[model samples]
Structure formats: C-alpha cells, structure tokens
Target: MLYYATTGALPIPSGKPQYQQPSYYTSGDSTYSVSPPEDLDASVSSASGVASYGNSYSVTTSYAGSSQGEYDSTGSASGVDLNEYMQERFAATFDPLPLDKCTAKQAQTSGHLNAKHRELLELQAKAQARLAKTRARFAQGLEDAREVRNDLEWTQKKVASLKAKASKKHSKEYTKARERYPSPDMY
Candidate 1:
C-alpha cells in the first residue's frame, strides 16, 4: 500500500511486526489517542455529533501492547500463520511416495536395487532425447519432401512441354531432347 505522508519524515517500518509506540510529533499543543482505524470508523459512523481537531488531523491505529499487528493483518489470520499453513500443506501433499529409488529407500529401509534403478533412469533419459531428435528430424524430412515434390512436378511439366515441342520439330537437337526426357509411360 502507498502511504501519503503529510508530516515530516514518517516511519513505515517493514523489518518487524511489533512496535513499542508509534507516536506522533505535533508542532502544536494537541495530542491524539492512538486508536485503531476500524474502531475510529465505527465510532465516527455511529456518532450523533461531529468531532474536530484544531491544528493536526489524526487517524490513529494500535495493536494491544508490544504484539503490534498480531490481529491487525488484512484477514483474520496473519502472514506467519498463513506461511505455516502452506508449509504443512506442502509437506502433507508429498510425504508418502512408494520409496522405490535408492535414496528414497535409504531414507526408509534398504531393500531396493539402487544401481539398476539409476541405470534405468539414465536409459530412459537417453531414450527420451533420441525420441525428441527423431521427431525433429521427421518434421525436417516432411519439409524437404514438400520441396522435392514441388520441384518434381515443375520439372515434369517443363519436360512435357519440351516433349510436345520436340515432336512438332524434326531437328537432331529436338529428337535428342525428346528421347532424353522420357514419357510418363516409361515410369
């Protein structure tokens, strides 16, 4: 939250939760009680008359004695409580696997082939790498096939035109070209 401080050099400490006394230094001759904002809101909301301050305006907040901000968090539970709850949930979520691996078996009892497990894991990793490489090569092969197919079709059309042109002429070069470019029946 951004605080708009209207006074000289206010202390908004983040290092700790508790504070001894968050006192206000007034240059005038008035001092205000350190009441919680919600409490003041409640009081002001239920008021029959308006209250006024002369020189300095005060909106006070307090948490009982040294345990400041203990019950003053955004919600009913504080940050520390929330962190502990999350840690417990994390531990509970993953604490009960089968303990099949060597390190996990070592953590429990010692009755598993640790070396074979490691070897199998290494083999699985190698197999996965090979599979990924094969897929990439397969995609490249498809791209190359597309280019090859387009070139083949274009070359076939050009040769077909040449074959037709060669049949219309009786020159030696045209005869050689007509024979050099075989007809589709040859395939």
Candidate 2:
C-alpha cells in the first residue's frame, strides 16, 4: 500500500522554481527541490513543506484567483504544513508527560521476594553449620568410647595379674602350714 520512488534526474518545468524532496530526514542536511509540472495550475500547492531547525521557513506559494488548486491549498487543514503541525503537536502533547515509576504494590512484592530469597540462603547456611557441628560431636563421642574401652581392657589385665599373684601366695602358705602341723592320728 506504500510506494517509494527514487530517480536520478527529473525535468523541471519552464518559468518556475522546482521543488525537491529531502534525502535525509534526521540530519535535515538534504536539499529540497521542486520541478512544477507544465499542466499544473499556477495556484498549485508546492511540495516544499514547512521545515524548522533553529528558525522556521514556509515555502507555500500564494495564489490570486479562487481556482481549484487555490481552494485545495486554502482548505481547513492546509494553513500549516503537515511536518510543522506534527512537530508542534508532539512538542505540546508529548514533551510535558513525565516518565512513570514503579508502583507501591510492585515494590512491596519485589521486596518480599528478595527477603524470602535471603531467608532461604540463611537457613541453608545454618543447616550446613549444624550438620558440621553434629559430625564433630559424633567423632568426639566415638573417640571417648574408644578411650573407655581401652581403660576397661587395661583394668581387666591388671585384675587378672593380681588374681594370679594372690593364688600363688595362698597355695604356698597352705603347703607350709601342712608340713609344720601333724595330723591328730599321727600325733
């Protein structure tokens, strides 16, 4: 539905200044030239629209009679050029509007999520610390159990040695007493 045309050279009609379309829209460095058609009326609206950077310029041609071209040019929306009208409207309507900020609800929701994430991280750290402490305590308990078992073994060995010595001494005393005292029948 949109058509874009580009040509190398276009002839300008005799006895009138030619109107040209700009090449670049952003920089405004492109030149605007016009070649009025031969059959075109004298009151025809020029293609050169109002353009402004620092200063404003209007290139619309004035017509004498109330011709069709003159009537069309003098229409209600025709007083100011399209580009000028758009620029003015944009400046008036768009320039004053401020940028929107995050709403209170959104801020609160995000804060809650952040707090929850931090809480989860803290809990994980605590769990790991507790697990390490439990492991350390378990190892300590195992060491204590091993120490108690070794003490019990040492006590058992000492008691066995004392029992063997007491048995030997009591046997010797019994033998000496029997040799020293005779039986009643023998006496």
Candidate 3:
C-alpha cells in the first residue's frame, strides 16, 4: 500500500477542509461525511479520514473523506461468550476414566528393586564402552597395511638379487648383509 500524493501531503486535517475537500479548496462547495467500519475507531479531521487501532496503529486519508487506499479494522467478541461455548462443547464430548478396580497382583509389582540390580547395570555400561573403543580403532583404516605389503615385495626382490650376487666370490659385502639383516619378512 504505497500511497502517491497527487497535490501535497496526505491527511490534511478534517477541520481544515480547505486542504482535503475539493469543493472547499477548489470547487467552492461544502458537503462531507465520515463512515467508520464495524471494527474500527474512526473519525474525520477537516474532511480527512482518520482510522486507528486502540493506539497501536493509525491510518489517515485526505481525498474528499473517501480515499481508495484507506483501510479500517475493528472486530472483537467479548471473553464471556467464548468461555461458555467451550465449556458446553467439552461436557458433551468428554467422558471420565475409572482407576479404582485393580487386583492384588497389580499393586505388588509396582514396587522398586534392591542393590544387586544397580551393580549389574554398572557392569553393562563398562562392557558397552570397551566395545565402542575397539570399533573406533578398527574404523581408522587400512592404508598402512597396503604400504607394508608393497615394502615387503620390494625387499624380497632385493634379497633374491643379493643372494644371486653373493655366489660370486668377490662380493664379500652381500654376505655381510645376509648375516646382519636376516630378511624383511622375518621381522
């Protein structure tokens, strides 16, 4: 609701009809009336329409006391009428429940347990924690396994070449390596 002011500022006072009423301001005639809504506290100020909520919001229009953009809201029912309707509807629709007919067995089972149950509950909690920690570690992953497998294959090939060269009488260092490191797979 953006209002465009054609002549000047909107809401020219009703008492000062010269600013709002076309007849009073330009045409030189005099006739005006204020019409309020069923749910509004409305009035007129020098031919300007004045409508407002209790004190929260307000709207005024100045176009011969009947602007197309003006709006009024004023409808509220009292509290007593609403309360009576709700009570009557509830009595007709609702029924009460009976809790007075229980047997001896029902009364005895509602009692609390002794100390042994509490100890068992604590033991169950510890078992669950241990299981959770094991699952978390296993979930860390398998990349290290793949790396170790690759290293083992490379070391095996290196050892086989060293053993082949060690058969040569002049290769004394290969013999020393075989004694010192054993084999990568053994470790």
Candidate 4:
C-alpha cells in the first residue's frame, strides 16, 4: 500500500532469468548458432552466394510438375549415356584391349598332348574371364557416377524451385509470410 501510494504502482519482485534453449543448426559435423526469427537481419545471411538461415527462409509452396524436365527423360532406358561421353573424351589414350584368341599355336606341338591342350584352353579362358570382369567393374563405376550426377542435379533443381516459389511476387501467401520478415532482397 505504501509503495503503491508513493510510486502509484505495486512493488514488483525480481526473479532469476529463465534458462533458454540455444537454437543452432548442424551440417555434416558442423554447428551454427541461430538467432530468433524476429532477430534475423543482414548479419545472418551468407556472403558465399549460398542461402543460410534467417533471411533465407520464407513461405515455400510446392509447384506441380516441378520435377518434370529437371532431367532428360527420353523414355528410353538409356538416358544421357556418360559412357559415350567418356569414350569420346578418353578414347585416344585408353584404348580397349583386343580379345585374346586361343589357337593351336598356343597348344603343344608334336602329336599335341591332351593335358597341354587343356591347360592352354583353361589359361585362355581365365584370361578372358578376368578381362570381362574388369570391363563389368568399369561399367558399374560409370553407372554409379552417373547416378551421383543425376542426384546432385535433382537436388539443385529442387532448391531452386523452392527459392523461386518463396520469392514470387504476386501471391497472397508470400505477403503474409513477410509480415514480420525483412525485405526479400535480404534473402
């Protein structure tokens, strides 16, 4: 009553500051501190031309048929044959070996011993098998590389689509999303 009479307000008790959970982001063994959405501004943005948190975030809507034409879909099983490109690129230095043929010349002479003929044929067969296996492995590596390239391309397209959707001008949701957010140029 006295405090209220003198200051025209009741006495207020001070309490300890409440503990807050720190916000951060993780990316492949790295961590970054994140500010509150309202506190975000020019500082949080990345200068490497890549989108970071804060100004980078906005209302992102899915656009239909976004994935279509992101990559070539020829409807054929063979799409963007990397092997053809590789052959053209490296054909000069790394030429494919000719298949080794097993002939009578490789076998024993003077009434051709049966054991020697069998041994010669077996060696030839083994050599051919090794060559075939190596070729198959090379083909598999090329396929794996192609898959990685496609996946990267798809991811990039998806990110780009999201950025475009978020930054689109004549949209109700975009305006609403920017209610408390800063200018789109910050993004």
lDDT of each: 0.53, 0.54, 0.47, 0.51
lDDT of 1 at 49: 30
Cα displacement (Å) at residue 120, model 2: 1.3
Candidate with best lDDT: 2
How many residue pairs collide in each prediction? 0, 6, 8, 0
lDDT of 3 by residue, 1-187 (tens): 2122233333535352332322222123543332222232234222234443232222223454454543222221332343456778987786543333344445544433435567779999999999898787766546667788899999989987876867585467766876787876687
Most accurate candidate by TM-score:
2
lDDT of 1 at 40: 20
Q: Which is superior by TM-score, 3 or 4?
A: 4
Candidate 1 vs 4: which has more TM-score: 1
**Span of 10 residues, lowest total lDDT, candidate 2:** 50-59
CA shift of 6, model 4, Å: 99
Alpha-carbon deviation at 14 in model 3, angstroms: 91
Give the per-residue lDDT of model 2 (tens digit) for 30-138: 5444322223233443344323222112233334552313233222232545456767888788733233344666788999999999999999999999999999999
- The digit string of per-residue lDDT tens for model 1 on 93-124 reads 86555645656758555435676788899999
User: Candidates 1 and 2: which is better by lDDT?
Assistant: 2
Give the TM-score of each candidate. 0.33, 0.41, 0.24, 0.26
> Global CA lDDT of candidate 2, please?
0.54
